[model samples]
Target chain A: MTPNERLSINQATIKYAPLREALRVTADAGITSIGLWRDSVEAASLPEAARLLADSGLRFSSLCRGGFFTVPEGRARRAAMDDNRRAIEETAQLAAAGAAGSAAVLVMVAGGIPQGSKDLAGARAMVQDALGELAADAQAAGVTLALEPLHPMYASDRAVISTLKQALDLASPFSSSVVGVVVDTFHVWWDPELFEQVARAGAEGRIASYQVCDWKTPLAADVLLSRHYPGDGVIDFAAITHAVKAAGYAGDIEVELFNQDIWDTPSADAIARTIEGFEANVALHLGSLSGDARP
Target chain B: MTPNERLSINQATIKYAPLREALRVTADAGITSIGLWRDSVEAASLPEAARLLADSGLRFSSLCRGGFFTVPEGRARRAAMDDNRRAIEETAQLAAAGAAGSAAVLVMVAGGIPQGSKDLAGARAMVQDALGELAADAQAAGVTLALEPLHPMYASDRAVISTLKQALDLASPFSSSVVGVVVDTFHVWWDPELFEQVARAGAEGRIASYQVCDWKTPLAADVLLSRHYPGDGVIDFAAITHAVKAAGYAGDIEVELFNQDIWDTPSADAIARTIEGFEANVALHLGSLSGDARP
Candidate 1:
């Protein structure tokens, strides 16, 4: 009954580490799970990356991304869907397919508004159409497309889906086994409907990943990499974790921070902080704040 | 019939202009309304500022701000409440003291999460409690506390109220005559619940002010000043303006750009661009998009 049983270190938190080296350090620290970007896998060759993850004795929590459907229909859009199909193939290789939490999810970051267009509605329509088209391929491969709704600030440039409710609605058309969403704290902690949405996501069995991180103030120059470790900022982890857990979630808690400061640290030290932050700020408070014992 | 009838140049958009100079140029530029920040009023002396505004024949749209209740109870909180009473008095002097978008609004930016505290709920509760204490004073002065929900990025340090729905809900206990909400495009364009919320605010007779500005991408270093003139960014002004107009709003559409670049421009040239951008991107589209004809 290790407290770190559900812990997973997303490699993005320490991009400075080589893939094999990151895995070695994660294992050395007695970590049991991981989430990886497709770029890392591609850099090492998919076969080698998969072999490395399999040898590390760590659960493959999810793959980084698969959607950028904002491109206008034509060659670019077709290529995106083809790329996602390949991503599904990779998820299948991870061999954690299931209808429940056992499945390894392929995270979908619905791309930003297309170039030279202010048509947010048109961009969103493309995401829905892309999801509907890709859902069958994902189901056929027995892997899930983990729809991720980024913060609204990223709406015009990163993802049109900016709320858990929007993500859930987009996934509603697809089966739970093929489509779900990432409940990433940095993107959704400020949502007024968070508790209710988390409960709904749990009931629908669409909570594919629950990523934790803090939102640092005076956001870094690169807004994308401004996330801090949990407890380092203002998010109330206890309340959110309680809501997610109460909604029947039992899965790995992944730390996927994107801060440049965190990236500069050696992987081992960063891993240590991630573990400490998770256990102290997140894991310790999950069941307690809800006034219910851990399931 | 001038197309810019409802246009009002908020002094923040022309940061380079002195108070009297801004008023004079606004008058010369054929503008009929202006929104004032208390800092500027304090700088010129309230009596002198009021005399200038009254003499210039400009409609005083609203006052800048009055809420910072994130400071916990005791001395600091009492000080915030006292400041708000002073603001209400000034709003009364603005002489736009009636609802239906006629009254001068005492803009309220609910304070950010308190120092060293991750409790967003607690901060929001403080705002509500503080509002309850000040609503009577605002009502007595015939000024509305126009609650302004800032963008979520500012949730930590500017305002906890980040949506019109949340602002309206927070003001629900008070009469709409005393408590209303602002419709600011820059702060709320990413909101999925925007149209519904705008309609609801109008239905409740609580649409106190409508502020227009564009959210530029690659946000400037100072996030507070990243706003652009209308049509300079990706917000669908025609769509939002149509929705607000359809909701029975007929009042000055205040241009409140906060960009350093805009502020650096010569006040007259910047003010000219503000008017042009509003007409092209907002005003011109409003009556046409709504299809009922401008009332």
Candidate 2:
């Protein structure tokens, strides 16, 4: 595979760079695929961001996020759904010029339990309600809502969907063509059932995005920013990446690091190391497809 | 249910205080049961600590913990297993004078992946091997090994077993009377299959310990010390406590907070809030327990 065929740098890994600069640096790195974040798309006018990606000759792999459906109603919940709908529209515009990229996959990071509420079940139900409200619209816009189950550490404060099984369960009501799940190494490498779940996800044809990032030891005080590039931590990426590949996943793998220390580095340097780490710790596993990872 | 009948303070909750002082504070606060830690018992001299609990009339709920079987090697592995046997001996001595506490329940925290390794499956296998080595001895010494599945966030550096299902699976090969699993609210509260697992554990007669500790939002810098008292966090304690009750788990609920902020506070005040939180968030579910809850 060409570098562009397999590697995509998620904008969050070089968050300090402006949308145009991020796209430019990623493209300049000889990587021809990129993932955009909703914030970055909005920061530049959506039309201009679309024009930039169109002109840069990069396949827009996926969008960073569009789900925070964990707030209670009145305005906050409505506002969040409305924002997500708008994100879907933005994703549609960017993918209009799709090449090998079929369409922009909009990742959904389900928000945590609502504030002043401990009803985890209620919060999860709300996520489903929001998805039901938006699923048809997503199909209309040609944007797939990819549910991303974050680490359980983020369960209370970020996403209640803390496993691939839960994400698929939530997505089961919708057609796989419109809704799917993300298989990100950072969120799921610790799972004892990782191989089975990956295979299950593959069989269901519901893997919408494949994201890679390493979990750094001595985690940052703000654990959100503790993710390093692939090889920097203890995750056995060759095993996880191989699991995804064995599961019939042939899509672009996005490198989405969230380290504050890495963010402080120049975007060029960061993107360079991301590519290096991906090649060394992650991409090496892409060569073979039939091997089953051990439990 | 009487306050003393269901509630017990784990020594690690007030780890700042001496073992004798923690027990004194517990007894002074009208609590008649407590869980001891190996460090606390060692600090006070095991015989003296046992004498204190026996004299104070506090029913020992369970021992704090005794499992770090992830270390690799002949001497290192043997050393860890030996230490665990000694812990069983200590537990047996403390429980000889029992009132509603037939045998000492030892909470086993299977250690994380060993240094220079990323083999999670191997670490878990090693844990099973160690349990096999100790199960007979634990049974002989009148000790029940309770495997605690910590939150997934602790999977890399603290424990490899990160789910109730995995813990139950590991304990399956052994007799329930010799091995069991801990249902810690702080750890397993985020799981999607929590209720199902709780019921499975109960049906299998493996709910050895029901631990109560809240997962504090905006977790402390040291993730280890981020546990709050019951009502102080977002976990729906009523839901979890009720599930454990419905699952036929009749066991002492140990409050095992590890917050640094609370640790800095006077032990008496911490113990007071624990009881208050227990009554408010956790014990309300205890009112209709079908006469189930052991000391």
Candidate 3:
């Protein structure tokens, strides 16, 4: 029943599960780690959710998200910033409640262009400004703000940050531990500069979280749900995994799928499939475990 | 009925139009130029298509396509190269038979990663090899091999070349006139490096064509047909059009809509809408026509 030591199941892969059920199913599947979504954590009340995670003994890999800071200056923008501050505190607390290897990393999706706006550069600038405002809070809370670059297809309404190089550039001004980047395979597999950016991110000490999922096209009617289990798509997992490993990203690899079909499967079945996919497609290229996993 | 002198209707915008109808509809709409698709041209017989275009007194903007060179070296690969050679010859003849401002440019869409293979880098290298093999023939035939960078969404199944920088790098190995690039707004409007790369393409003297279309969400079930008319979506045409103009490109600006709804419209009605969209969204930013249009 032992899964790959570095495997972490992002809760979104099992969308319908309540926080306690998600933790129990992941633990019972022999998976030692989980990435929590803010909705489930909030729904259960953070204190109770934290207790459930502690009892499950699953290491906390990362928080599902915290950055939608593309709003223009106003009450809405202020509210978004305040929410992010709360997320940082939640990330810190969740990591404290999990097993020894838990990472206090909050994945950030710099939101799409502010509604009714076509100023992409301006939206991106807002992200940088938001980071400047939030970095000190994140640092104080000991939470890493991990910026994720979504695929370009979602650039207008979901995320304007669309390349690893762009994400790295945005993170350049802050300390690596305070502000870093997420290398999600689903979002960045198409980037021409991926390997080079992976190396550059490593050199700059900005690789905060590494998430994996496969990309098969004829994307879902909702392009957001187009992710698949690894080894199920055309993505070259071996080449990308080798690059990430070479770049010294020695941490839990989270599988965060958004596909409706995968979400419909039972939570334990989904986790089992994720383990099989990771072991067959990604774990083989990861070399040895590097002593980073907690029992 | 006088359209912007620089405006051109790419034949695929009206996918069902035969060569004669496409030419007649475009000229009747007062559009001075048209980009022809190879299939329609072949349908009319290249010679007859050229005669129809010349009779319509429309300038030849460019040929619809020429490259799909991601196959492994074998009979299929050899067949693809031969087909590209024929495309070059057709481009030369069509440009020769058109009005004075005709451009002998053959748009090249580098094929996707070969089926069942995940070697993206290898597929890209094959594009380079294909271009090298055909550059001499293109140069001799006076055809500009316009390497087009489709959106990253199409990287796995349509075109491996998904960025202007990548296309430019591939074209750098040959003369700018022999190997050039297409600046299709629908494909590249999301690129973070777009403006910088547009300036680079201009500086390199490698911009062979400039195509415009818009992007909106709730993309079609078939993503290939997701393109919209210029003003129909969120792209900042003023900014991008200005960038292209500032890059010193004075060629015909082609409006190539691939949306199913647009294709379903009567051809003349579609061209009419394209003119309106371009005039409102792109033309104003284009500044004064640079004496490049023919009467």
Off by over 4 Å in 2: A1-4, B1-4, B98-103, B290-295
Q: Residue by residue across A5-64, what tens digits does model 1's lDDT show? A: 788888899898888998898888888888888888889888888788778777788888
For model 1, what is the C-alpha lDDT against the true structure?
0.85
Candidate 3 lDDT, A1-295, residue by residue in tens = 5888899999999999999899989988998999999999999999998999999999999997899999999999999999999999999999999999999999999999887888889999999999999999999999999999999999999889999999999999999999999999989988889989998998998999999999887789888899999999998888888778877888899999999999899888898899899999988878763432210
* Rank ordering of all candidates by TM-score, starting from the highest: 3, 2, 1
DockQ winner between 1 and 2, please give it. 2
RMSD of 1: 2.9
Model 1 chain A worst lDDT run, 10 consecutive residues: A94-103
Candidate 1 lDDT over B152-234, as tens digits, reads: 99999989999899999998999998999999999998887888899899899898899999876898877888899888888
Best by DockQ: 2
Across B127-173, the per-residue lDDT of candidate 2 in tens digits comes to: 99999999999989878999999999999888999999999999999
Q: Calculate the i-RMS of every candidate, to one decimal place.
A: 3.7, 3.4, 6.1
Candidate 1: CAPRI quality band: acceptable
What Cα-based lDDT does every candidate model obtain?
A: 0.85, 0.87, 0.92
**Could you give the C-alpha RMSD of every candidate to the true structure, in order shown?**
2.9, 2.4, 3.5
Candidate 2 structure quality by residue, lDDT tens digits, A1-295:
2353589989999998998899889888899788888888888889889888888888888887899998877788889988999989988888775446645699999998887888899899989999999998999987899999999999999999999999999999999978999999999989888888998999998998899998867778888988988888889887888778877888889999888888999999998888888888877778766665645
Model no. 3, DockQ: 0.54
Better of 1 and 3 by DockQ: 3
lDDT leader: 3
Q: Per-residue lDDT of B1-295 in model 3, one digit per residue for the tens?
A: 5789999999999999888889989999999999999999999898998899899999999998999999999999999999999999999999999999999999999999998998899999999999889989998999999999999999999999999999999999899989999999999988989998999999999999999999998788899999999888888888888888878899999999888898889999999999999999988887754432210
